[model samples]
Target: MRRGLMAWDPQEVPASALADRLARLRAELAREGVDVFVAYTNIARGGSVWWLTGFTPYWNEGLLYAPAQGEMVFATALSKRVAEWISSVMPAGEVTTTPRPSAFIGEHIARDGAKRIGILELDDFPAGHAQAILQAAPGVELVDVTEAFARARNDSDAVERLLLTKADALAQAACGAVDVSSAHARDFIAPAESVARLGGAEECFTLVAGDLRSSRAFVRTDSMGSLGETFAARVSLAYKGAWTRHVRSFAKDAGVQQSMDRAHAALMDFSLQSGETLAQAVARTFGSLGEVNNWVAEQPRGSYPLAPVANMAESAQGFTASAPFVLDVELVTDGRRWVGARMIGL
Candidate 1:
C-alpha cells in the first residue's frame, strides 16, 4: 500500500494534459478498428493506466474502458466510500465501483455491441477478467493492443518530463539525506524514506547494497549490520504518478568517495546523442572513468513503470530520443565496485 501522500495537484498536472493523452489513445484504437480499449491496473502494473488517466490505484485492481469515442469508464472493486476521492484525482473518466469490475466492464461492452475489443498486455491480464468478458460478449474478438498503446504513449510530453524531473529531485534529496556516519543499513533507509514521504511522494522504495566490496546486489533488508568500506543506496520514488530512481554510493575512504563523485558527475553530463545506442552512450561517458561492467536503461512501457529497454551487452529495443529513461551503471574503478543510477533525457 502507498504510505505517502496521494492527492491530485492540478497545478502539476492540468486536466488538458490528461485529455490530450486520452485523445491519442482513442486515435490509435480507431486506427486499429477496435470498438473499445481496456487496460487493467493493479498496484504492480498501473503505469499505463496512470499515464492515460492520471489515476494510480493505491491498492486493489481496476479496469479502464475507453470506447472509440466518448468518455472512458473506470471500473474498480474499491469501496464506494473512496470513490469520490478517486474521482477527484482522476480527471479523465467516470468511476464505477463494483464487486465484479471485469463483469461490469464486460456488461458495458455487450450493451454497446462492441465487436472488436482491444486489451493492453492481454497475456498478463487476469484470466478471470477475460472469462467474464467472454461470458458477457461471446465470440467478440479480443485483440492485444499493447503495441498500439505503446505507439500512442511512446513519446514523452512536457508535463510528464517536468514531473519526472521533480520525482528525480525527490529521489536525489532522499538519498542525500542519508547520514554517512550511520552504522546500519536501516539507518540509511530511514532518512531516505522520510525525506521522500515529506516531499509528497506517492510511494518510496529504498534498496541498499551494504557492502559493495562483498556484493553489489541491492536489497530491501534491515538485517545487515555496519556499513562496509563502501556502500550504495538506491531510492525509487513516485510523485503524482511519475516515477524515477536515483542511486548513490558512499565510502569512508577519501579516494573511493572521489571516484564515486566523479562517476556521478559523468552520469549527470551523459546524454544519448542522435543515432547512438545506449551502450554507445555509456561507453562514451564512462569508458574513461573505469571498466564498464554493466548498464541498463529503463523506461515506462506497457504496464511496467520501469521496463528494461537496453543493456550494455545487447541492442536496445523501443528506445526513443525524446522519451525519458532511467539508467543504472555498474563499474570497477581501481578494483572497487561502484554502482550509480539517475534519470536520463531530462
Candidate 2:
C-alpha cells in the first residue's frame, strides 16, 4: 500500500491536460470502431488508469470506463465513505464505490447500448471481471485494444515529464542519503525511505545489494548481514502518478571508487538521439569507461508501471526518442562490478 502523500495538485496537473489525454484516447477508439474503452487498475499495475485519470488506487482495484464521446467514469471496490475523497483527486466524470466494480461498469455501459467494448491489456485482465461484464452485457463484443491504448499513450506530455523529473530527483536524494560508512546493510534502509517519504513521494521501494562481489541481485530486507567491500542501493519512487528509479554503488577501496565514479559520469552524460538504438547509444557513451556487461530500458506501457522495452538480450524492441524511460547498466572495470540506473529521456 502507498504510505506517503496522495493529494492532487491542480497547479501541477491542470484539468485541461487530463481532458486532452482523454480526447486523444477517444480518437484512437474511434479509429478502431470501439464504442467504449475499459482499463483495469490495481496497486501493482495501474499506469494506464493513472495516465488517463489523475487518480491511482492505493489499495484494492478499480475500473475506468471511457466512451467515445462522453466523459469517463471510474468504479472501484473501495467503500462508499472514500468516494468523495477519490473524486477530489480523480478527474473522472463519475466516481462510484461498490463491491463489484466490473458488474457496475458492465451494467452502466450496457445501459448506454455500447456495442463494442475495448479492454486494455485484456489478456491479463481478471477473469472474474471479464465474466461479470459478459454476464451483464451478453450482446456486447469485447475486444483487446492494448495496441490502441499504447498508441494513444505514447506521447509523453510536459506535465508528466516534469513529474517524472521530480520523481527521479527524489529517488536520487533518497539514495544519496544512505550512509556509505555503515557496516550493516540495514543501515541504508531507514535514511533512504525517510528522505523519499518526506520529499512527497507517494510510494518508495528501496532495494539493497549487501555485496556486489557475491551477488548483484537487489533485495528488500532489514535483517541483512555486514556489508562487503562493495555495496549498492536502488531506490524506486513514485511522485504523484509518475514513477522513476535511481541506483548508486559504493566502494571501500579508493581506486575502485574512482573507477566507479568515472563510469557513473559516463552514464550521466549518456543521451540517445533520434535515429540511435539503445545498444548504439550505450556503446557510444560507455565504450571507453568499461566493458558494458548488461543494460535494460524500461517504460510505462499498457497496464505495467514499468515494462522492459529494450535490452541487450532483446534488441528487437526499440525505444521511442524523447520519451521518459529508466535505463539500468552494469559495468565491469578491472574485474570490479559497478551497477547504476537513472531516469533518462526526460
Candidate 3:
C-alpha cells in the first residue's frame, strides 16, 4: 500500500528569528565592505528576500534594503492601501510604478547615505535599472554579490524546514487528487486546487502527461483534452514560504512499472548522494537512464519554490548541508512510459 502523506502545522517563523537573520546579514555586509545590501524580487526570485525579512511579495515589485547598522527597510511598487495591509509583515514604503525601479532604490540609498551598495542577482537584474540607480547615486559604488547572498540563505532554519515539510504534504495531497483516467486533463485542476487550499497552501499547480511518446516536460497549459490510456500527473504546491512536488502515474500495462522501478531507484541515489557536485551526482545516479531512454543526466537543475528566481546556478558544488533544496527528476522508457519525482534535500 502507498504510505499516507505526513501532517503539518500551519505555524511560521516568528519576528525574533527574523530579527536574528537581519543581524547576521548586516554583519556579513560589513565584512564585504558593503554599506548596504539590496534584494530585488517580483513574483519569482523572492526567496532570498523572504528568507531574511519574512515578507513575500504578493504582487508587483518588491525590494528589501539592509544597512550595516540599523533596522532593515522594505519597499515595493504597491499602493498605499496594500502597503498598510503589508505593514503587519514588514513596514512597507511606496515606490512609484515605473520601468526603472532603481530610482526609488536610489532614493533609499541616498536617504541612508550608503557609499558602497551590493545588489543580489546582479547578473540577471535589468541593465537599465542598474544604470538608473547608479545615476541616482553618483558617488556610490554598486557591486554584484548574488553569490554571497545565496550562500547566506543556503542553510535552512528549523522553522524553514517545518514549512517545507508542510508544503511536501500539500503537494502529495494535490497529486493524490488528480484523476488520470479522466477524459479531460482540466478535470483534475479543481480537486487539486481545493486540496492545496484546504491543506493551507498559498499556491498550487497541476500538469498532465499524455502517452510516453508525446510526453513533454511539465508546463502550464489550458488545453482541456483527453489523456491516453497510460498517463501521468504531477502536482506541486507552495505553503507559507516553501514549495514541494509529487508525481503519480496510472498504466494499463506492466511495462511502465518495470521502467518506473528502475527510474525510482536512480532518483533515490541522486537524492541521497551528498558531498559531491550536482553534476557528478546526476552522472553517477542516472547515467543508465540514457541507456533505457533518450533521457540525459544534466547538472545545475535545481530550484527553490519559496523564491522562484530565474537563472540559478546549474552547478551544485557549493550546496551546504543545512541549505534546503529539491531535486526534480524525470525519465521515460523506450517502451513509452513516463516517470517523474522530486525529492527534498535538507
Q: How high is each candidate's TM-score?
A: 0.97, 0.97, 0.78
lDDT of each: 0.89, 0.88, 0.61
| Ranking, lDDT, top scorer first | 1, 2, 3
Clashing pairs in 1: none
Judge candidate 3 at residue 238 and give its lDDT.
63
Write one digit per residue (lDDT tens) for candidate 2, span 247-289: 8888878888888788888878878887888899998988887
Error of 2 at 115 (Å): 1.4
TM-score for candidate 3: 0.78
RMSD of each: 1.1, 1.2, 5.9
Give the per-residue lDDT of model 3 (tens digit) for 170-249. Answer: 77677667654566667745677678777777666777775545765554547546666566667766666566666665
lDDT of 1: 0.89
| Best candidate (score: lDDT) | 1
User: Where does candidate 2 stray beyond 4 Å?
Assistant: none
Q: Decide which is better by lDDT, 2 or 3.
A: 2
